[model samples]
Target: MSAPDLLDYSRRWPLRLVLASVGLFLYLPLLVLVAMSFNDSRQTTVWRGFTLDWYARLGGNLELLAALGNSLAIAALATLLSLLLGTLAAIALWRFRFPGLGLVSAAFALPIVVPEICMGVAMLIFFARILPWPAGLPWPLSLGPIVIAHVAFIFPFVAVIVRARLESFNRETEEAARDLGAGPWRALLDVVVPHLKPSLVAGALLAFTLSLDDFVITFFTAGPDTVTFPVKVYSMVRFGVTPEVNAVSTVLLVLTVALTALALRVQALAGEKLAP
Candidate 1:
């Protein structure tokens, strides 16, 4: 081999080693968790052989199942609301100029920039002060406050993703639709939205995942009756880690991986469609 080619090959080894090290750092714990989920032993650290007892037990855990259901319901509702509001906000920010536009944009982003614990405290205080419900109300923690808090934080992320997509979008298509006698709403629905479908989907998925995985904000805003899956997991782990916790973590890991793969597939197809 040529001298230059040999030097280039030598340079690539460090990059490969670094990437492998990073990949192991990130995924090794996940692999261990998955392995432990199937362990027959009650002890988390010891490997007593493989079994499906934990997975079987998960089916009978009514409280855990209920928490999971609550999580799914809240995430779905939050994602729907976030998508609607975020899309509108992104469009307005992208297409219009207004007084205090900068301020509005900054306000939209405060949730993302602020510490989650701070946001949680603020939401708790705000809801306690403003909610019309009396103190005597049974099950004071309803789905409403949790969903609202989730949307407050998740929508900002959605707006930012959609805005980034909008930055690369062409405005001429909407103008052409308008020229053909379409109204603003019609043009937006027919032209702009189709073009933004990928980003919208991506943003919605992100919002849903964040809502599902969030602990701090959910913990503060959630009521006794509104326990989510993550909160349930935290409650479990407070005692000590177990095979059941490993099972739950494995399930969540699989779910997140599946969703991430789906997002990548959708983005790839969208890119192909946009290709000239």
Candidate 2:
């Protein structure tokens, strides 16, 4: 090989090594956690032999199951509401210029940049001030407040993702639909929404994952009966880490991976549709 070819080969190996290192850095811990979940030992670090007892035990944990149910319920509700509101917001932001557009955009984007603790505290305080009940009432943490808090934070992410999709979208199809005598809403529904379906799906899945994984905001806003899976996991950890926690974390990791894969698949399909 020539000198330049040798130099190119040297650069390629270093880049490959760097990428490999980064991949291991991110995934090695996950692999360890998954392994630990199946370990027969109660002690997390010390592995005795492979067994399914931890996962089996999970099914019998009533509190964990209840918390998981609450999380799924909240995430589902929040994802639906966020998708509806976020899609509308993204459309409005992309299709029309209105007064205080910049301000409106900033407000929608604020939650993405704001610290979780701050948002959590603010929501807690806001709920305290506005909730219509006697101050002496029992701790009013309930499904409603948890869902509201989740939607508040998760909707912004959906909006941002959908808005990105809208930015690259072709508007001529909408115009063509209108020219064919479709009304504004009809054009949006018939022409635009089909194209945006992938982004909408991806955004909804992302919002669900975020809501499910959220601990900080949920911790502050949750009422006595509204504890989510993540909060329960946090409570479990406060005592000590165990194989049970590992099993739970491994399950959550699998779920998150599945959702992320689904999101990416939708985005890929969208890209294929857009491609010539």
Candidate 3:
């Protein structure tokens, strides 16, 4: 427990090796998948030569293109909706002291902590069984249901992120805006909204990625005609993995990495703003 007895974990070779092994264990398959996307052979395991033919085919695949469109649309709409609803939720909880504040606040965390399968099933029942579908129709389940379901799960994440930003906020700024003859709405827009921008951007991107990558809930909510990229990819994988799928996945991998990096950059900027 003394200063000399304190272990230097960074210099520990055993710990460093384990960490390296864990990183490889997690990311090695992704590296292999990226390699396979350019494989010339039909066989997934055998690579005859590197070729970009699969990417060409991916561009021409109508079903996949449609699915990609659907995914992007759903993700964008869900992100916007979640940003609005979650920001409002965070603001309410941040600024108010309700009778059941603890209970209401805990409710926001449920979507994050609850199992996805359970949430999916709950969504299925809510959309299918609970809602009164027309007598003959299949309730016209499409991007609509999926967007709603995604917003339900995704907004809580936005709320948590925004609330964290709000916790660091200086109330004096808003008070100063009010003292300068600004109304409530003016104070929020001029003072608070500017402060929330980094969190908002970060939350929006996080929600977009979560909605884009989601499968379980999307699977439950999708109609016969509705197909998002993840669902399309899953159906293809059920038959067999192909180079085209690999190519699309590689593109998605790159996009995910880019978005993640952007989020981190925003977070770093936010940290700089918070620093003394």
lDDT for each residue of candidate 3 in 70-168, tens digit (9 for 90 to 100): 999999999999999999999999998979999999988999999999999998898788873333444233567788899999999999999999998
TM-score for each predicted model, relative to the true structure: 0.90, 0.87, 0.89
Q: Write the per-residue lDDT of candidate 2 for residues 1-276, one digit (tens) a residue.
A: 788977775368778799889999999999999999999887648879999999999999999989998899888889999999899889899888989999999999988899999989987887778773233333323577788888888888998888887876778888988999999999999888887777788888789889988999989887666789989999899988868888988988887788778777877887897795
Clashing pairs for predicted structure model 3, backbone only? none
Q: Give the winner by TM-score: 1 or 3.
A: 1
Q: Backbone clash tally for model 1? A: 0
Alpha-carbon lDDT of model 1: 0.87
TM-score (C-alpha, index-matched) for candidate 2: 0.87
User: Which segments of model 2 are wrong by more than 4 Å?
Assistant: 1-13, 132-141
In model 1, which runs have C-alpha deviations exceeding 4 angstroms?
Answer: 1-11, 132-141
Ranking by lDDT: 3, 1, 2
Q: Higher-lDDT candidate among 2 and 3?
A: 3
Worst 10-residue lDDT window for candidate 1 reads 132-141
